[model samples]
Target: MTKPAEAQALPDPSGGDHKGHRERLRRRFRDAPGALPDYELLEMLLGIAIPQRDVKPLAKALIRRFGSFADVVTAEVEDLRAVDGIGDVAATALKVVREAAIRLARAPILNTVVISNWDTLLDYCRTAMATLPMEQFRLLFLDRKNALIADEVQQTGTVDHTPLYPREVVRRALALHASAVIMVHNHPSGDPKPSKADIDMTRVVRDALAAVDIQLYDHVVVGRKGHASFKAMGLL
Candidate 1:
């Protein structure tokens, strides 16, 4: 019974049609999955975390600010919040995605034969540490069955160096009854090539573990761009 002018004054119920837009994007993803550009991928994810908002611009802004999709998700929550539109929910969602990815990468290798499952191990190392701003040395302890018992980050240091203790490394393996170990460290410089110190330290750790009859399977150096293997390079 409202007049035409009164009807015009009432707000539109349909609003901006962002719901339909979101649905279209989701359909496109379901049909062609991974076909979207990285920005679109982030946009779709952000839409879920922040309903009713136009998230495309924010997604593009995040990628532009952080340099890539991986970097954006892996960014610290506080830093992500500093961006103009990202709030607690958005920041936590991105971080949850990154952590879930890291855990998924680890799943295929945990308690499995690391020697044969080498690729998954590298994936985990890359996910967990390759992009780190500093050096962190981690160890994968394996039992006689070649199943992983523990993964531990033993040291973290400046951009170029991480102090290692050969005796301590062996002692921990012995305590854990681990029969073998794989050492991993990241080069924030993005080159996986080992230094003279890296080679010397690997040898020292190998010899020390050999005394306890524990195997030094490998020392892996991961960088932002690639990874190196001591075994493949004949250094182990």
Candidate 2:
């Protein structure tokens, strides 16, 4: 057995508290000469929520599980929960960060000239809708010369389908007095390839729009893999 004097020689558990431990790491990150790497940044962010623990292991676990920072942010809630330390709070926090980034990207498109700012429109669409687990069909209404009038979600449906009504589309376009419109939807399977139904539906919308002298500018399909543009693909 150990001696009575040796029993009191154990290291004190409260020698350094949470704040001191975290401050040390923060100082290390701040003092690094060059820019901190992506993983290091992630570590800092994770530290905000999970204070008291060494976040490097958790950070590595997340990167390993999701493959990349974007993948981690875009991961489904269930997928994020599968990680050891990731709880509902952490997952939601990460999702909010992703959404904030998307909102920032979309700010330039909100009131700008839609024709010249097509890139921003694409960025907003990809960020807002592409990461969804189900399909959502949306419309971007524009007036003459392609100035955006409204952005609306027309329908939400299963992974493979949505109920799109050309009459409703026309009615909304007329209400907004939009001269042209762009159609957008997501493919949950991450394949943006247009199906036969997609092609047929576009034709129906085009014909319907013609009745009221509105134009179908293009159809854009967003997916996790990439995006497909009907105009670029010669399908418009």
Candidate 3:
């Protein structure tokens, strides 16, 4: 009697089918052309977050909603949830990616002298702060030579405003022994243009610090569009 055709066609149970597929993907990723497209990179990342499902559609949806890789990673959790197939798990995954990017961006400013890397410093500050839906006031404390000592979030407020106290800023600088400082905040409105109040508040902080012999290096306004430096603009 002849054996059944279906049984004859089946592969041996010991064959490494599961491992082979993953190795093929790994090889393709390593050998792929310049810049392994966003989807592929995202696919690899999502494979960690969602082990059992196809993540292409979700990744594509995120890109479509947020416009680019950076924007998607930086998007607010609520905005991320608005996309189809994005739930708590996906939102959390995107947030983890964003947090990693922020930490990477700030690495240069952490131990090294920040004054020398002004661009990276601003990029770090902006990337780290601009994702918030509400306003935030942050201070980057620096030593006498302008090396970063600590980065602190002083206050968080509503979508439009954050209460800032010049006296408190000065006091904190004194306590930290920070000879110089950089002030940074974000506007949820996506315009980096500094408002009159922003300028006024910056002057208040600057003057207060100046009285205590602490330099106010810059007041950086971060928004989705970009960042503006008050000192560079001659506003300080």
Quick one: best TM-score, which candidate?
Answer: 1
Query: Each candidate: what lDDT?
Result: 0.87, 0.81, 0.80
Give stretches of model 1 more than 4 Å off.
1-15
Worst-scoring 10-residue span by lDDT in model 3: 3-12
What digit string (tens of lDDT, one per residue) describes model 1 on residues 111-159? 7888788888898999998887679999999999889999999999988
Off-target runs (Cα >4 Å) in candidate 2 are 1-39, 158-163
Please give the lDDT score for candidate 3: 0.80
Q: Which stretches of candidate 3 lie over 4 Å from their true place?
A: 1-28, 32-40, 78-84, 130-133
Question: Where does the lowest 10-residue lDDT sum fall in candidate 2?
Answer: 1-10
Arranged by TM-score, best first: 1, 3, 2
Give residue 57's lDDT in candidate 2 (0 to 100): 66
RMSD, every candidate, angstroms: 7.9, 8.1, 9.0
RMSD of 2: 8.1
Question: What is candidate 2's lDDT per residue for 107-198, written digit by digit as tens?
Answer: 88876677798788888999888877678999999888787778899999987899899999999999999999999999988899999999
As a whole number from 0 to 100, the lDDT of residue 36 in candidate 1 is 91
